[model samples]
Target: MADLELLDKSIRRVPDFPKPGILFYDITSVFVNPEAFKYCIDKMVEIYKDSEIEAIAGVDSRGFLFAAPLAEKLGIPMVLIRKKGKLPGDTYSCKYALEYGTAEVEVHKADVEKGKKYLVVDDLIATGGTLVAARNLIEQGGGKVTDFFGVIGLPELNYEKVLAPSKITTLINYSGK
Candidate 1:
């Protein structure tokens, strides 16, 4: 079993980060602590170890942090879902709304094997726009997404609604319980 207390304590909450009134759950703190980072990967590994997921599609930058190790452990290929134009060769892209504006994500067409089941991963799930966009790109490229995983989630924001019909899992949730 994973130690929820240690993982929760490993995260640092920054107030008004990138803008005012925003309480950012900084996951970089996990990087500085080996135990917590290992715990995270171990937990996620446990979650999907017996599953039928063929690949992991990680969202740009942060998502790669968690996905790479998970894919390695599962012995599956890791696909990168990057921002528009970041990937080379023929690509599939999708646009999603952000807090301030819209952003686009893309995946290399070659990375996606048609009809293979994929799992989308990220550091956290706040509003779900990015993950939803990632799912679209994967499907548009002929890959099917079986689930979404985040290290943390903010249910207070009601993100599940935006990501409706898709299952998502998170290790920690800040819902003011």
Candidate 2:
């Protein structure tokens, strides 16, 4: 079994980050701690190791860190789900709401294969807007998102309801104040 207790303890919480009245759950600390990082990958690998995941779709920047190693371990290709304009050539893009504004994400047009199953990975799942947009972008390119995995989740943000019907997994969790 995964030692979620340790994972929880390893996480660093900072108050009033990016703006006041916001508590940021930083995953960078996990990257710094060898055991914490290993546990995250090990748990993720254990969860999807037996599945038919054609490719792993990592949701920009941080997601790439976890997805790359897991995809390699699972012997599957990893696809970049990047910010709009970050990827060149033809691409699939979608906009999603943020706490303060809106942001866009995209994937290379040729990366997604029709009817292929994919797993989306990210560092955190807060309001689920970003992941929802990522899923829509994948579907637009004819790829199906079988599941979504994140290192931390805040269900207080109603992420489950927002990402309904799709399997959502998180290694650590936090409740809102």
Alpha-carbon RMSD of each model: 1.7, 1.6
Q: What is the C-alpha lDDT of each candidate?
A: 0.91, 0.90
TM-score of candidate 2 versus the correct structure, residues matched by position: 0.95
lDDT of 2 at 115: 94
Residue 91 miss distance in model 1 (angstroms): 0.7
Q: Please, what are the lDDT tens digits per residue for candidate 2 over residues 90-137?
A: 998899889899999999989988898999999999999999999998
Q: Estimate each model's TM-score.
A: 0.95, 0.95
* Error in Å for residue 166 of model 1: 2.3
Residue pair clashes in candidate 1: none
Residue-by-residue lDDT tens digits, candidate 1, 1-177: 358898999999998887987888999999998999999999999999998899999998999999999999999999999999897699988988998999999899899998999999999998898999998988998888988999999988888887777678999998642
lDDT (Cα, 0-100) at 88 in candidate 2? 77
- The TM-score obtained by model 1 is 0.95
